[model samples]
Target: MVVGDASLEIDTVVIGAGPGGYVAAIRAAQLGQSVLIVDKSEWGGVCLNRGCIPSKALISAAHQYETVQNASSMGITMENVKVDYSKVQEFKRGVVSKLTGGVAGLLKGNKVQMFKGEAMFINETEVRVFNDQEAPRYKFKNCIIATGSRPIELKPFPYGGRILSSTEALELPEIPKSLIVIGGGYIGAELSQMFAKFGTKVTIIEGADMVLPGFDKDLTQLVSKNMKKHGFEIFTKAQAQSATQTDKDVTVKFTVDGKEQEVTGDYLLVTVGRRPNTDGELGLDMIGVKMTDRGLIEVDHQGRTSIPHIYAIGDIVPGLALAHKASYEAKVAAEAIAGLPSVVDYKCIPAVCFTDPECSSVGYSEAEAKEKGYNVKVGKFAYVGNGRALSLNAPEGFVKIVADAETGLVLGGQIVGIEASNLISEVALAIENALTLEDIALTIHAHPTLGELVMEAAEVALGHPIHAIVR
Candidate 1:
């Protein structure tokens, strides 16, 4: 292992240390491949260091604070409810540190060599690991590229100072008096509502007609309604034009209904989207690997790239830029390298938005099923009719199940209410395993539980709902 040596060889090399990359590395190692996983950044990458985990931590803290502020409905009373902003950040960092440390331990326990540097392809079978002082060559029998993505920056609002990305917002020193969010996608909607819970005056400007565009409107409507009631000012069909930052505040100029308007806030958070980190020195073209114009690498069912032994997964490849999605692909890619018969399956990949009343969906939406030429029969049961939801004082949304009209097979499911994030997994399993409505309806879900909503939704789809009046 000489510093200047260019002859280090491994059975497999995984680039990036994110969820996808780390999982690929571990799985490949478990299958008896000598693996080396490298990343120039922190161990857990953006999701742990900045995106999902930290954002969720902040959201959880904000939710707790909001609960204390509004506990009168529960006949519980508290005085002088306050949030220590620094403590919240401390808690977030602690959570990240623990998980990242655990990941490192896993890699070490699995005997996966960890390297810290950037990787550029020398050829289909070779990658040069570069650092400030050394350039080491790592030759591999196989390589998996799991380099993720970064937050997309808009020219009109370059991220600096008051105009922040999610990464910066998660580490804000104090709760801003007001926040102007420029996108209403999952990241934007989730963070804006989280801040609103912490008493930040938040305004969201979205280019779409509704927030959480990836979700069905009926589901987003519940979130939109709750956000508005929580004092979030959202302007759909709005496009941000520019931002003027100052020492005290920032003024964001946007357009709505063909009229230009400005909103002043302490900070402006931009979460338009993310671009794959496939640019600048990765050398995909040098290895004759194919990628889209948008820089998303082309991969097959087993996450194999144009160069057969060279594989790609996660945000760098096509599909939803989700942590779970990348991890799923990671398993398939690693198994493929081990000569196992494994391929990626996205039929029941669940997407969850952890807002006030969490929303989750798996498999196809109602419209998606119909478009795919399935005669979809959809039925919904509201939380208002669920005993668990009423007991929890959260009866604001519904669970809808989509099934095949002829076969009664569960096609997909959507939930918009408390614990929706947790509840969607039952539906995901049903769809993934090709379970039918009767399979769920016959399952004895415990009475006075949130999970009954799934059973109830299934019953409604079967036209034999026992809880709610079938409409």
Candidate 2:
């Protein structure tokens, strides 16, 4: 570590070593730009350390537990079905450690300097990196700010003790007997279901009319059904009034349907949304970086900020707070700094929810396509008709494809079922390359496989679906 006030010169400096920052650093190094990456927290940031990785790990464990217990429908019976949460937590930590370690290895392989400290901007071309032990300064020709966001905390339910955030929710040493979740979005729904599968009674309070307000209601309906099956109590169009916590449990007050109600639980988790990490002592305002009232930095098509040489991406920029989206923008920003003509294309960004039924969407939805002035034709296919779905004993969802009525262009697609996260990528690629419904239909898809669902949906759009009747 460099001590004292000597300023080390670098070609590019990346702030916040999350998915976005590390990727930007590696790409910049690959482009022959000497790069230095710094973060105050973990190397892989929240996604790998506390957010995506750990949550998904627990989700996977919970799913395994559910699958084993519910296998009687498949004529498979097992006794003594149980989940040791301590072992599950150990597995989650192993996954996170492996991934974060990979990030460190990748940075080292790329020859990028890594620093552990908070980075504060001194000017457009300079920043001071410091920790408890020492403070060092760096002068850079270019910089990429990939600082991510944190879970938004409601004032009425400050995170502490029994009041928990997603970070704390994931780190619970043992599963709580009951949990009260304040948001029903992806985070809330995912965590609620994970804990519910672990035998926790979960109650969700959502201000929106439905959970996952961003997704189409039909797609979310299956998820809500599964949540109910797991004994979850959902209160929609509700507001969290306040919360009081005792040493043993927390009680939350809220209102729904013009009636005030209260629920008590071992923990109260608030996951309404996430606020960008663009404020505080980082000194964006001091360096003339223009930001919105919401603290999002305004960026150009290539992720360049108000200052030509300075760039911002990921949660700090104006877009969905997804780690993959940040990675996509990271490459573009790095290439732009390397004098490449790379620009970000958001047309094919896919979003997925790791819920029980696994909902995913890419490009435009049916309503979104129509709102964009496209005459849309939609094709729907149910999983019950698929042999693989039936054989797997998981036939509780469908695939819907939206296309242009006039030109047969594939506009968008939504999937709610098994491996929807993996299935949406093909649709995303189709939308990204401007492929038509005929293109997908013409491709030979193997029989009895989930991929056929996409092909059959395309066939339905073309007015001749072999597997299902066209009404």
Candidate 3:
């Protein structure tokens, strides 16, 4: 590699052009700062290229297949429906390519310099980016680190042939006959159900008492019920001991309630969790940026690190590993860099799981509100009460609103039903802007729609639900 002696000066340098880094670069450029962004891998990072987009595409295809197979209940019968896994992969790749190309175009349109290389800190305000052919140094007034995270590799189940991580699992060439999932978190559960829909017999081993451990049991139980209907075998509170693989199959040994048991599958997918990419040759420690023992960077409200000129956002920082959260922080960090008074508010960060019936939440739960010493009131409206839900043949969940009994201020919300991902945003916007139960209830939603569920739940909170009985 040819090393350049003189450093190229930039106003702001963003490392890791994932959702966070690219958005930061563009926002900084919009703020009139000369920006440069670099990524060692793909332009859209893991979320767009590997995790979110590809997985969703496959899930969509599987869903269509399942829908067609189950269309008898809707008075439509189909025969001989099949999945072409290769074509599904091609469609996924096409979506990824289009979005990544769009990101590149946006960067160019914003006049942000792009570099494809690995970057490490050389000094306080300088980093050296190295590719296969050249190594160049960059000096910057401010820098944002958004390197993101990777799947945690378990010692007992090292990734290889049949032992796969979420990244590798998404890229499988052919659908396996059977799959054993190690974790029952959102990632594991989503993929498990997706493949189950695709006619793969899936067995989920979860160490927790239930799948999707963070969510309230009512919501997860619905998902678990749907999974069981799709022929998923779940073993909760099971600890995986070891994994052994052959050329054609893999076997995982686990213990349920201290009794040894084993399961064999064509592939073993480990969706345990992800760890921040704060280690390695990044040289964060040498530059004096403070990070927690768990490999998370400590950042202020404006996303500034302990070092004033340096900032960190997204998975590398202390927050949920969410793409939108990273993008939100990216904007605040960029605005702060431009001497604008911008800060992050974690009060209304919504989380969604794209499962069979979909689950989403924002702000707090009823138990959380009561735990925080607020006199809480919960209003819940069942999906069965909605005409649109019955029309769509998906009415197995509910919309719940939690609020202060005294103030009627909306504290939080949880939705579990069809289109929950899209519906949760209304509650999120309400919470973010301090809207109350009355505000949501008074807002006229279209008749016979899923969004009316939110209004009905709010009206339930007000003790006079129009669509459902008060009892």
Candidate 4:
């Protein structure tokens, strides 16, 4: 330790104040541990500041713009409809700032000490925090690493000038007349659709057979269909080779179906994926914290590493790099550190994508259930058959549920339509609590609501659907 470097003793220390880190710090503090959290950047981390919140803010604006532009069907007409990209960026920034501020207040209210700095583990028991200059040496009884991740930059298309990462794409001073998005993952799809709705001629190049590859083909089809109607171009089975940029535009080269193709656009937004922040200055190796080959920390059920006292969560762990997943593990790790029986559970973790109609899923799908060796019964309810959907004039998606044929236990569910994100939670809860299709079907769902689609699908699974003619 450097001379004159004061030493502070802490019950728990959390690195990276993202959703996972801050939540763990707060939970540990609430559990009567003297918690201290160190973060390098803004309080809310990537999810709140750059990823989830800001993106959603822009998505909401795009939705509003679309709704207003297409209200002629509702006997509403408006002229001179236009989007101001600068104002949109301002709105997104405001949302990010407000939420980040709220997170700061929450940390303070929970009595968790906040340190704005970069932390590197000196060893299993000690960490040195630097904020331009080093802070006091912190000797912690236990530590949680939630450093999260950063966007990966392709070497062939390094982010600069006309090439943009998700972070840079979100902060574009003005919407480009044309944009090419590499990678058809949720981040790419969501931003592509957003820019399309904002009047950009958007093209998405996905290496997979379909965009949003993790989602079911049916869901991706619906999203792709909707995107196509907006004059968006999509290329599947495509490989991005390289990119060259000038002052005003970028030209991307790629190959598809044994043919080389090139596209020139005002900007190229690369949303390939994110890389974990476990390397470099994190110093997990020095502390004997084992990491997997992919650079993610190896942790057990309670988010504990090989080192009993140090734990990891979120993007640093081996599951989906989602904000909610991180927050969930954060609580579990904090509780486990406090001598509670809490352990990480991925059973009912829900994933929601804010596409045009939105997409959400929880637990296993029909294929997953079958792969797990369970005999399955599947029920699918289309939005076109639901009253609330028709009333909303958005009848273009479906709710599908999979259950055990013998036991009627709800195994998993998927949704593609309006409020899918909000609607998927009910099914997640049912699966988490081991509720069955009969339970969901028997429960009275209010009439003329989107949630009724879920109930209708459950009835179909039980072989007694009331709304639509059974197949």
Q: Is candidate 1 or candidate 4 better by lDDT?
A: 4
For candidate 1, write residues 115-154 as lDDT tens digits: 8889998888888887887788988999999999999999
Could you tell me how far off, in angstroms, the CA of residue 421 lies in candidate 1 after the best superposition? 0.9
Worst 10-residue stretch by lDDT in candidate 1?
1-10
Compose the digit string of candidate 2's lDDT tens values, residues 1-471. Answer: 575677999999999999999999999999999999999999899999989999999999998998899899989999998878899999999999999999999999999999999999997888998899878899999999999999888778898999999999999999999999999999999999999998999999999999999999999999999999889999999998999999999999999888999999999999989999988999998989999999999999999999999999999999899999999999999999989999998888999999999999999999999999999999999999999999988999999999999999999999999989998988998998899999999999887789999998999989999989877
lDDT on C-alpha atoms for all candidate structures:
0.92, 0.94, 0.94, 0.92
Superposed by TM-score, candidate 4 places the C-alpha of residue 112 at a distance from the truth, in angstroms, of: 0.7
- Give the alpha carbon lDDT tens digit for every residue of 1-471 in model 4: 346866789999999899999999999999999999999899989999889999999999999999999899888999999888888889999999899999999999999988898898887899988787656689999999999999998899888899999999888888789999999999999999999998899888889999999999998899999999999889999999999899989999999998999999999999999999999887887877888898999999999999999999999889899999999999999999999999887999999999988999999999999999999999899999998898888999999999999999999999999999999999998998999998998888898799999999998888898887786
**Pairs clashing in candidate 1?**
none
Task: List TM-score per model, in order.
Answer: 0.98, 0.99, 0.99, 0.98
Q: Could you report the Cα RMSD, in angstroms, for every candidate shown?
A: 1.1, 1.0, 1.1, 1.3
